[model samples]
Target: MTAIDWADYATGDKNAASRTLLMREFLRRAALWVDHLGGSERWPFFDIAERVDSSVRADPDLLERLDEFTNANVPEFIARRMCRAAVHWAELRESTEVTLPDLPDPYEPLIVLYERGGVFFVENGVADFEMRRVPLRTWQANLAPEPVVEIDQAVLDAANEEVH
Candidate 1:
């Protein structure tokens, strides 16, 4: 799929633009996770959890951005799991040597992102729903053309209102 020019909406509809930017960030991270795991294959949430943990260690502020993405209430289960995994992993990392944290309950189902004929689709762990597809030129296209700024909650709220 062609990359969205989020900047075009900047002046006309700031809220929508911000929301799209957020989704772009979420998808970008998902694509990276898939690449890190060595091609698109069904992956348990735990694997993603470990990656999330390491990512947080490298960039402390990533947790906050993940939190913001989760709070935006995206409909995809994978999105929620990604944020939840990050939180779970971070708590585990905080455990002291004397008192190790208990293992978190396992995440149900499995998610995967695969490519065919140069297009990508996400196999959302649910059987009832069909796989979700997003066409793009390449994995690198998932990255935003420019830096994505932090979106204000009020802007999200306004965008949600417009949608309703």
Candidate 2:
């Protein structure tokens, strides 16, 4: 499908007819975008275009319908993004404050600390062997030791030989 230059709609006279046409166009584009993403199932996003089309055909007071839709408290973000408009939207009715669930910290498991002398430390098991050490004893003691595993010397030597 050909892309319509939405900027064209923004130009010209700012009358009721023009506004209605622009709103209808925006709703159509939003419906197409919704269909492109996935057909409406849980949410009836695509139905917006049909409803707006009906309103346009009926030549009703779009501003009143828009106010009603806005008062219903649908997400403004989705409309703003899909409609390609820079206009500020106002809600006619006051909306209740939404309480978001507290999110858990992703880095909670790792211990982060600074030594008294100013050396920083991380207590996670993972370590970089190539880390530079100014004080050898303190660094060695703090780093978790690699577990020893028994292996036949001859078999190990043969495996290393194959890799080389």
Please give the clash total of every predicted structure, in order: 2, 0
Instruction: Flag clash pairs in model 1.
Output: 1-135, 1-136
TM values, all candidates: 0.33, 0.20
Local distance difference test values of all predictions, in order: 0.38, 0.25
lDDT of 1 by residue, 18-131 (tens): 344344444455455555545444433334445434433424476667656545533445445554564554454664432322322222111111000111124442211122
Off by over 4 Å in 1: 1-14, 42-47, 50-80, 92-146, 150-164
Model 2, 1-164: lDDT tens per residue? 01222223222222222222222233333334344434444231123223212222212365445445434432333332222111111111111332212321111111010000111111243211123111212222322222111123343334334534
Compute the lDDT for candidate 2: 0.25
Best by lDDT: 1
Instruction: After superposing candidate 2 on the true structure, give the runs of residues whose Cα lies further than 4 Å from its correct spot.
Output: 1-14, 41-164
Query: Could you give the C-alpha RMSD of every candidate to the true structure, in order shown?
Result: 13.8, 28.2
